[model samples]
Target: MTALSPLDKLMPRGYVRQMLCFPSTSAEVSHTLKTGLARVLADVPYLLAGIITSEDRKHVSLSECYQTLEDLYSEQDISDAIDYVVIKQHHFPPSSFAGPGIIPTDTQPPFPNPTPVFRTKLSLVKGGLILCVAVHHCTTDITGFGALLKLWASHCRTGASAAAGFDPAWLNRKALLERPDTSNRPTPASIPELLHVKGPDELTKIAALASQPSDPTTGVFFFPQKTLQALKHAVNKHIASWGNGGWVSSSDILTALLWSAVLSAESDPMSDRKGSNTIGFPVNFRSRFNPPLPPDYLGTAFIMTTATASRDDLISLSFHAGSSNDDEPLDSASISKLADIASIIRASLHSIDEERVRNVLLYLDGASGDHPPITLGPRHDGVSIVSWADQNIYGLDWGDIVGTCDAVRLPKLMYKRYPIVLPRVPANPAGDEGLEVIVSFDRQVFDKFRQSWPMRRFSTLRYYS
Candidate 1:
């Protein structure tokens, strides 16, 4: 009776929603998305020939340009909506998006909705792409997103010329949620194990974080490879601090090294006593629950904050070096300590209590409410709107980043969905297994945080160049 949805050909799919700023002044958000998607739809089977693009070392841009092209603000606002569409860009022909053939149970979570979730937006400047791609979270992860991104970027590099189906599907919350949980889950542990925990009563809000910088304004650029290498060197040197009992997690090591630099920048920026914070690793909470999430379901799996601690009394460390036999380094943890902290975080993971979700969601989701900043003083309120975003790297294949005979291969469904999913190259051990980083922050906080830690002089890893 109803005309089949065009994307039925691309079943078992995932979604990637990105907000991009265009060189032009056009304000139609959906138009930009359509411009990109439509370009890919053209003879993809022939043009790409299974070759995925890799945005390996590109630094996260602050903006493509400073001036706005020319879209009416009001009209842009009204049309600034998202559209979801299905396209078969993964595996080839006949059975385009057939059953992933894994276990369907993955689609089922303890929550009322069993479907996997996918949708995210990031705006660097006044105009960019608000990308939205739909995929079954049960089968795809950020790794897939990386690959998909390559495909999209490829198309963009080629041009935003439309093919047959240049238009996109409007993002329908109900339709996405209503989809069946047909994930072809392979392993049991791969599936989420539902764990429940009870925390303090109705979390009106979690404590806020704050830090003082010598400068009132500093440019915060993504770290470059040299900086990352220097950081690794510094941490390795610190590892020599193994006295009676020295320990730290990879997270702790990285945070300490990076934030220390941030502190240094603050000291130089001593224009006045300005306070700001730099938070990283908004870790996904997938494994935290019972029946871990399927490697596929591309939802907002987990979100955790790793704050700064340079204050004299607050100088603490939490790194976990691997076992004596392993190079992983001791994870800022001990046998008993791990069990205890796991239980604590696990408790935080399970407790759904809507009140808890609502309150904690503020900090977790980066809500820019009237709540004051954590360690800093008040003035943090007027920053701006509390919009949200994440550049989840876990979606990529970071584990087996080492050895490689050829190009990195990703699940077909994912390559067909998002704009920026790809594999790192020259192959390293990290690729054997992928390591993705999910960075979530409150936009308001980010603005304030940016002021304190100038990214202007900062850079990223060589891999990212």
Candidate 2:
């Protein structure tokens, strides 16, 4: 049995599901996937292992298990998983594929007995196929998950004997549990990125948030390359005047933009809502290690960092309160406000260096039972933004039979305030490379979000039931 890292134990008990859409259907696709997965398991046997929880259910480990391809792979009619119109339009309508029909239901957490770490399903549409892979979050993070998909695609494209060289060392989970010397450990309070909700009241609030019903109006918004460039340029130009010679990334600007927009849409100006609105985002620490973890090292190597702004400050930055004209240039005050928000995000991420990472690891190492020194969930009124923008999900090739993926979709999240930033799609014929963002909200908030000036100014919004 391989013990999971402390951070892994903190992952929510659930499966991370991803859907890859292909423009062509094939009779042998399922067979190819099964064979490829078998080959992958042969090389990375831990993936086939079953997850075992500790007596108290506070920790988890992987146990070797014998499971066949039949146990993991299945085929169902396309209509059962998604609408036929999705194949024609090449874009999934919001909440259209949100159900569990596409993924393995048994993969959901709270396993009384050990269960397989991975599961897959394939559905063939009229002119296309949808491949769904669900991996337990405790088994790997998104980077590791992407690596598994890429390797699976490789095995499918080339014969198993073709030597799709992959390092088995990357699968070592214990590497993440390693820590610095005792003298170098920092106190838990030193890490501002973490929020300790150990009090009964705070824990109750978090439980309330978790058990809240999910909002139905999840919308997908696409922003083209030009618009992203414009937003970055505007922020960079404003910050350059400070003469500090530092600059913020496009991601920082986009995060600020979305954070402000979402908070604005949910803001009830009439209500006496005070306090800061925080945005928590995960920062990949794979490279922050002294020697730096391998690019393909397969384990969770990130921690959440938060950036906060006063509710009033965020409201002032909201596009809803900006100029009525969509095309009008941002006023000087607005530009400055945006630049400030982006700077806060950039600084918060930059704060997580090797020392801080080690400090967090040491802190979590002491956690037990249901209480950890830190909480990964977003604050009650805050938003959590997870970016898959750098993940190479769209580039996974399944040989000439299926070619490249046409698009990717994530299932509706249980947390309505959480938003995911998907990878940028390849440039279209018009030379526009666009990014897709999925956000969930109730009908009223969704309506306000759809009409928000940022949505009107920078993206095309699509809604579905």
Candidate 3:
């Protein structure tokens, strides 16, 4: 049995699942879908199995490494249950897909002690098909998920033998664990510290915030290619002023814009207190380490990094709060702020060089396997932006059986404070390339946020009922 690595143990006990909806022209395609998915699983035996945990929660291994087809795939007919368009409208869905219940970590008898960590459910609806796959975070992250999708799509198009071409069994974390640690010692700043809520009061506050009395609403806003280009041009102009800002990617600018917007929408009194609003983003280290990991290093090879700026600085740089005139054009006061935001983000990400990543690996290498939670997301103090821009989610195709990808559905917002950024598929085949950001806030705060011409000028917004 392959053992779970130290990095795997640090993953929060849960699964990150995505619901991909497709337009189905035939109702008799279930068997074909099942066959394709089975082929997909057969090629990746590790994911078709279950996780075995020792008496304590410290150790985990893959057990029952080869299970029956039923263990991996489930099916249900939900044609008359819900509207498919509602799922389509959601740009950035919450993490909880099926329901609100958390996946049980400890063993529970009679119900399958060591359950499968990776699962696929095909929900057949009237006009469309919903393919839901849930894989524990300990098993893989979004990058790995993308790999599975590509392979599954290949299987659906061709057959199991073709799917084997994209199999990732050879890219496990074992190699990372076996590598020697020759990097310098890690300083406190080199490692990520936990910021999980402690005590009953904090939990209660988070629960209350999640379940707002007014029921927070989530909106998907689309940013067109022209707007993105304009923002990049502004950012580049500002970067030219700095002696050495390096190259700021599209994701850097997009994340900086969202971070600034979230800060502007904050209602907390402590938001302006010192470093009240810190922005954190996840850095993918697969290609950043000394001896860079292979492109197929499918495990969790990412680290979360947070950059703190004064609340005033963030708000001043925010699109909504920068210009304060009814007739002011979108570009009046956005250049410097956009530039500043991009600079801060670029600097934070640049700090995670080969040596820095090696230092973090070494630090975790010596830990007790149970390290503190890596903080990422909209915190009580600030907001976190997770960018999946590099992931080819829009390119998923299930052959001619399911036709083209109808829509990528994200879950609903469980927590109103935290938000997600999703790069959406273009409106038409020739429409502008763009991104969709899903955010939740109080009705009043969101109202103020949406009203800002600067925010509205760059994108079109749609709220979920």
Candidate 4:
């Protein structure tokens, strides 16, 4: 038998399974979930664990695969793992990102925006077709969900849970939330809006960026480990240089990098174009909500840090919040401005009364009654999405259970740069770990931005230019 991941010894050997049921069309998702899904969560990890991992471990990685003696599972375990992956595999109609949940809708949703966590779709292909289901993991963690997927995949190939000895209830989020002080919600300066609990459209501005095909404006960049190192090094230097009087947050750093790219495009002869770009980070309302967002609440824990700038605007954001004296050189001055803006926005987010966000939800929940009230009416234009994921809780042990975390990471890009996620492929059996970015844009915006930072260009450009 293959060695189990370090955390697998504590698994309870069962699964919480959700069928990723896809239909002839998208119209079937709401109809099916409304009629069938009955609980906040139906545990099924045992059944799903086996399905996702192969006996020889060639196709996937079981970061948590070996079976524990205490966690024996069988086909009977299928009923347990249903909550995180949603109720039905959602089908988007042929065009436009809208789906069947809305009125006058005859078609499925247009998977326009990636929603990043859009329904956490689960799929199993067989007999020339596939079955899918969706769930918001606000109910569990990625490790739990990944474990669940393995169970489902295992089940499909072997039909018998006896072979895998898997268990779905293996110390999941439910068990963790029960721990003391897990409610230490992050007091970050920014967070993202949960794409979940909100309606979906085919081409959300964020999705459009994430899915873009080229780097027409970024002037061909490389993202290998070396590049990542250089980025980290550059960041270290940038941070150290800005002693104080700047408002630089992680989100601010991300925004500055991407906006710089957008700014570069504004002056580009071929790709010049003006448009609004935004940045949003996820903020957990765990402390703000009633019952405190289920101790195990897993998916999309965030509020957004949204800031926008048009093509001609020279993103003069400052990092230092203190000195407005502007004694620094012009190039350094620009960076400081960003720092200041970031600090201001950070204050805005911290100031948001937790009670207010909670009240809005409570009011909506009461009006909507038992029905899930998150819906999409119309898609907004020019509002691209940017977010980051944090996974600090997966390291803890839950009495009889334990977990290992692979922290979440997101790709950053300008509006025109659609990033391609490394989906499962032949060379990548364990699958791609993160998203791949490919930048592109109108030549005009590109030209303006290229000239906007002649100072930065001369300094850093000496290396890459």
Best by lDDT: 2
TM-score of 1: 0.30
Answer with 3 or 4, whichever has the higher TM-score: 3
Query: How many collisions between residues are there in candidate 2?
Result: 0
**Better model by TM-score, 1 or 3?**
3
CA deviation > 4 Å runs, candidate 2: 79-90, 98-100, 109-112, 160-163, 179-195, 210-215, 271-275, 320-322, 368-374, 377-381, 412-417, 430-432
lDDT string, candidate 2, 284-314, tens digits = 8898887788777777788788888767667
Whole-model lDDT, model 1? 0.27
TM-score of each: 0.30, 0.90, 0.81, 0.38
Superposed model 1: Cα runs more than 4 Å off:
1-18, 21-148, 151-202, 206-222, 240-254, 257-465
Residue by residue across 1-465, what tens digits does model 3's lDDT show? Answer: 455665665565566666777777465567767787778666666776676656775566667676677766767776666455665544324432444221222212332436566777777765677777677677776777777777777777777565447635445676664555554444444443422324466568768864666666666677787778766876786677777745576667777666666666664634443454677677887777556776656677777777766565566654445455634544534666666666778888877766655555555667554654333322444356776666676776677776666555565654464556663565566574777677777677787566654465666775553
User: RMSD to native for every prediction?
Assistant: 18.6, 3.0, 4.8, 16.7
lDDT of 1 by residue, 14-88 (tens): 233222222222344344443444454442312111111124411111112221112101122212332111111
- lDDT of candidate 4 vs native? 0.32
The order of the candidates by lDDT, greatest first, is 2, 3, 4, 1
Query: Residue 54: error of model 1 in Å?
Result: 40
lDDT at 95 for candidate 4?
Answer: 16
Each model's number of backbone clashes?
Answer: 135, 0, 3, 129
The candidate 2 region of ten consecutive residues with least summed lDDT is 189-198
